[model samples]
Target: MASFAVLLRAVNIGPGLRVSSADLRGAADDAGLADARTLLNSGNLVVTPGSSGAGSAADVARLVEERLAERVGQDVSAVGLSAEQLDAIAAANPFPAAARDDPSHLQVHVPFGDLDEAGIARLDLASPGREMLATAAGVLYVHYVDGIGRSKLTPKVIDRAVGAPTTARNWNTITKLRAACAGLASR
Candidate 1:
């Protein structure tokens, strides 16, 4: 079975679904994903596909949604990315200096599906405030010099701009996920 990184959207935020990482791990294990592991609380999970014919991103997303909704008592949707995909995203980061110097300042909003160009063009890239870098891999690398809270480029804004369901994670989380993927690959 191949290793997959599953990113759940709109979970553990505000007053929404509050499933803990530990509980999520149990839920994933119960859902038949081998050696399920979670990082932090933003719903980043690394799992091995357990079924005989299951490794696709769409398959993993369906499995997570089905099991997590039953186990956590709420609708939880996810997007699956392979270990190599995660590593490629890390390597394609446009603002490496910003990520290295100020990880908190550099953030990424990744779509669970293909991003349409017409939707992405809605973003005002020429705006004087924040900077957004789009890669061919469909990940947006953003840097807000004044911090995320102070910037207008929210997750909602990105979702609107890209017109795709997405989840946001900081540079630190991205790097850690890459490392986690590497660790899983070695196993």
Candidate 2:
């Protein structure tokens, strides 16, 4: 079985949507995933399933969407990452030191096929105290000198820049997710 890290988009945050980490694990289990675990309430999941192909990601996403939509009567979406890919993301981290002290630094994971120079240039990321821009790997890496909660660039802003579906985790969370994936693979 291949291991994957899945991030649900725009769910369990403010407003009416409320999905617990236990709910996420239960969804994975219902979808036939093995060794399912959740990182936090923000919808990060580490699951080992029989496959790691994008097709499998799509299936997990569709199942989760269907289940959540049934529960909340609203649509939801998800993005999945292979353990290898997550490891690559961790290795590709450019501002590890900055991220260590500053929880505002984040690694935004964008679909590899959805990145373009023109879209990135249109982000208008010139705000002071927060550095936000699209990276070569299609991920928008950001460092908010002030807390990200106070930063002008929200997750929506980053998504608009990439012009596609995206999910983000702080640098520390990314590293921990990477380790979890790696450990799962070793077993």
Report the lDDT tens digits of candidate 2 across residue range 1-187: 4677887877776785777887787777667677778887888888777432324655556666666566556666777778777766666766676767775466555552466556656654455545655465446666666667787777666666667767777777887777887777778
Residue-level lDDT of model 1, residues 1-187, one tens digit each, is: 3688888888888997787897778777777777788999989998878752456756766787788888888888788888888878887887878988999878788886677666666676545565655655678777778888877777887777777877888888888887887787778
User: What number of clashing residue pairs does each candidate have, in the order they appear?
Assistant: 0, 0
Instruction: Give the Cα lDDT of each candidate.
Output: 0.78, 0.68
Q: Poorest 10 consecutive residues of model 1 by lDDT?
A: 125-134
Residue-level lDDT for 113 in candidate 1: 69
Instruction: For model 2, name the residue pairs that clash.
Output: none
What is the Cα-based lDDT of residue 134 in candidate 1? 60
Q: After superposing candidate 2, which stretches have Cα over 4 Å from the reference? A: 51-59, 109-113, 124-129, 132-134
